[model samples]
Target: MNKVEMHHTIMAAKARKEMTWDHLSELVRKAPVWLASVCYGMNSASPDVAARICEVLELGEDVAIAMTEFPVKSWEKTVPQDPLIYRLYEVVGVYGPTLKDVIQEKFGDGIMSAIDFSMHVEKIEDPKGDRVLLTLNGKFLPYRSW
Candidate 1:
């Protein structure tokens, strides 16, 4: 199965099982965000992790194999339309330069490594309304002078 097929199959199975990412994370001992990313085909899983995911989801070998394959990691060039996603894009668009300046000031001339990154999502309860908290942690790779 290809990534699209695997994603569909996994999502179907998950819905049928009435399973949440947090539940799956508890079962598989992985972060819910990371596991969800793997399921969404944005990231690849190791062979063992793929097998574990398939086993928990009661999926077949094809899905497991597909999960282990590397992802293309491409997205549409246009701005995202989904409200939440679009807001995130908007935040970056508004604060991208500010963030760049602050990060550069602290870390020097370099970039954050998405390849070596971890993200976490948290819900903060409040009387007014719940708030979403996202933490993005990445290694700072300074540019090397050649």
Candidate 2:
């Protein structure tokens, strides 16, 4: 599958795993909202964030390495860009809702902002086949009313 398709496939699979924002967030002492943002592809992962995410997901180091290869800049010119990068935009725009729904259901009104977040994607070989491991870490900011 192409990047966009691959992105969706990954998301759908993760969603099916029934992973909640709190479950993943609690793994790394990050905010559910921030983690959600990374999952939905609205933000990029920094190195420190990636390491923390790996720690929480128990995904190990290999996959964590690929994940840090993020922050890809696709568009930054006076004109359009390649079709590959374009797919990323589409994937994010469309799947964003799905990610948000899952996060809200798990964390209530809070959100996983990318302001302080990180991610890591790696491939691991299992008996069945190779699996892609993803880890995300963000600051856990509990929402409150003043």
Candidate 3:
């Protein structure tokens, strides 16, 4: 199966099993966000991880093999309409320049490495409303003079 087919199969199995990403993470011993990304075909899984996931989901070999393939990692260039996703895009649109300036000042002429990154999502409960917390951690890579 291809990545798209793999993602659809995984989602269907997950929904049928009524399994949360957190539950899958506990079973597979992986971070929930990363695990979800793998399921969504945004990231590749190691052979062992793919096997473990397929075992838990009762999926066949094709799904596991597809999971192990590297992803294209591309998204639409247009602004997202989904409220949650749009809010994140808006945050980057507004703060990107400021973040670049601050990061450059603190870390020099370097960029954050998405290849060497980890992200976490958390929920903070309050009387008013619940809040979402996101933490992005990436290695800093400085430019090399040629």
Clashes of each: 0, 14, 0
Give the alpha carbon lDDT tens digit for every residue of 1-146 in model 3: 98889999999999999999999999999999999999999999999999999999999999999999999999999999999999999999999999999999999999999989999899999899999999999999999999
TM-score of each: 0.98, 0.37, 0.98
Top-scoring candidate (lDDT) = 3
Q: Residue 37, candidate 2: how far off, in angstroms?
A: 17
Q: By TM-score, how accurate is candidate 1?
A: 0.98
lDDT (CA) per prediction: 0.96, 0.60, 0.96
| Candidate 2 lowest-lDDT run of ten | 1-10
In terms of lDDT, model 2 sits at: 0.60
Where model 1 places Cα greater than 4 Å from the true spot, the runs are: none
Q: Write the per-residue lDDT of candidate 1 for residues 91-136, one digit (tens) a residue.
A: 9999999999999999999999999999999999999999999999
TM-score of 3: 0.98
Please report how far candidate 3 places residue 121 from its true position, in Å.
0.5
